[model samples]
Target chain A: METVILMLGWVGVFAPVALGVIGSTIGCSRAGMSACGAMLDTESGYGKFVGISAMPSTQAVLGIVVMFTLNREINTLNAPGIFGVGILTGIALMLSAIHQGNSVASAINASKNKPEIFGLSIAPAAIVEGFAVFVFVFALVVSGAIPQ
Target chain B: MNSDQYITLMSALPSLGKTYHVDIPPISRFQLEKRLNLLTEEHQALLSDIESVLHWDHLNSHYDDSELIQSATLVLEQLTHKHYDTLREMILWRLNLRTILAGLRYRQRGDELNHQQSHWGVGDMEAHIETYWQHPYFNLQSRFHWIASVQESLQKNDTMQVERILFDVTWQYLQRCSSQHYFDFTAVVTYVLRWNLVSRWSSYDADKGVEHFQSLMAFALGEYQQLSMGIVVDQNGDSK
Candidate 1:
């Protein structure tokens, strides 16, 4: 019974990455293209916007790494706090990555008619980032590693 | 037509649908000269400071807010041209190199515009004003597209108009990056993200430029050294 359960946990760990990438990649691509496309008429001062969209992927990458750590920890003994960390971090990571698309969409809308005030568009993306920060903090609590 | 006529046309509107005109204040010579004086003084101090912090050939637009940079550049134009003969030739020489560098900036990427034209000829405020209005890229297109749109807005003015265009275009660029429309990416970038492959990689890089971005920064910084009094610190007050 334990052996089968361990096997299932392993699959669960990797599956989110595979599925998340598949499910989110196209949508993310769409949102990003729309945001950058808003500057079709003007190309100056756009590097900042393009720069942030590139950053949201870190959420996805962290989620994948967390999953592997989860699978290994779960097989060892199911330390309850680790499981909580796994689930919460997973939820936070997925949610942040998905929510970033909304900011991307809003940024596109704002870009077209008001290029000068585009810095304000970062507000939404920053809010979505709170979840990622939470995950990082919680992951640290569960792992409890001291700096060398 | 001369620059005044061009300025008048730019500040007008697209009456017939194709040709456009932008509007500006009907400044008498005295008023133009006064405003020009204030603009010049403000920029000299700022540029002098910038030269202290940032190195030439390593500038980036995002380092300084575009709003701050644009206003500074406009001021610099006024200072270098208006009453410039009253100052040292060295200042004008520095201004010339700065302008050329600013031109390459696409808008202050490296804290330097790639338009070093101050030394190219002898001129007062009027000539530089004329030159500014005469340039097809900054004058005809940018003013017509960005300035006119903001001017049409009930509450917008010249400064507001520039800000509006910059924000609108920048926001759109963000959207295009999110969506991954390859063509749109090409269209929305400065020289750094000009190619599709660069866009592909930049979509996820910590910084947006991929590889060419570094090269672009180098170009802008190189120009800053000419006008800035000393080594210019980047906006962050960090050495590059």
Candidate 2:
């Protein structure tokens, strides 16, 4: 039972990092494909596509931070709390990254043809990022409540 | 199709919105030349057609107004069909609408539909209009009904009003597609269609060009609202 609890704690500590990285990887690649396509259409504004493609990488970094924060000794009382928070937060970040990637891809596509809409097109992606931030903050605040 | 591929094709399209001006005289040689220069070499045939029309007008200085209108319509229809494959399917829909209108006019004049002057390359609605009107599909049936409602105006030979109705239907269809496929190729297709309509309207009547453009812009805003709501989903169940 003690070993199981300790294993559960380890799972909790690494879940966010694993899930977040997977999400970011998929997200970044999707956005990167769109950015590559945009480059073929426009002579300038390549920088914007590159920058938008990197947006999903932030979720992975946030996941790493959360994992570190939860990386203390494992116990039955705290194990479930860490496990729940880590898994839930990881899922939120993953979904947010994937969806945000799609939004950024759309922005890149739109702006490639009409450069004037560049700023306006990114608005949707930014809104999607906001949701990820909320999850990140919530996980951090709630993780502190678990008995160490 | 990929978003980038769609954007690349869209970027290749000429921006006629910038070239068309409400204050400019319609069909001036200089204006036509400017428009021709903006197009790629593939559209050289369209330029030649326009030149021929101008030459005919010059030779027959006393040409009747109806004759001039007919010639102009022929030139536009030919141009629309010239690069049919290169354009999006949405454009084919517009061309088909024009062909259908022409067919209606011919029928009202007691002329055979097969004797219509203009020929749409592919996706010609006239070729299968009977099937479209009688098809069991709900969407096709609805479209047929909508078009059928315009028969009264067609009977009266209100060509301008009929054309306006067709434009409205085309634009609304494009708007719906753009909204439903916000992150797909449809968005770019919608933009190009709007640009085409604006260019066509400006050339047809400079006085009403700006007003028509404003209405299109308003419609575009509504499309953008639909896009932002993330209600758009691809046919494959993907939220684009």
lDDT (0 to 1) per candidate = 0.43, 0.64
Worst 10 contiguous positions by lDDT, candidate 1 chain A: A34-43
Model 2, span B1-240: residue lDDT tens? 444344334333333333233444323445334433433453445445444443332443344645644665676566456543333355455555555555555555675434354442224464565444333221343555545646678777786787677666765665665555543334443544455455555568555767967666666678786565555455445865
Candidate 1 residue-wise lDDT, B1-240, digit = tens: 211121111111111111112122122334333322322355435434433222233444555534444444554465455543222232333343234323423333333332553322221232443466435333534322443343344233344354345445433443444344222211122111112222232234345444666666666778774556344655546765
TM-score of each: 0.33, 0.53
Q: Candidate 2, residues A89-123: lDDT per residue as tens digits?
A: 88988988888888887777777767899899989
Q: Backbone clash tally for model 2?
A: 0
Interface RMSD of each: 13.6, 4.2
Maximum-lDDT candidate = 2
TM-score of chain B of each: 0.20, 0.42
Query: What does DockQ give for each predicted structure?
Result: 0.01, 0.10
Give lDDT: candidate 2, residue B185: 35
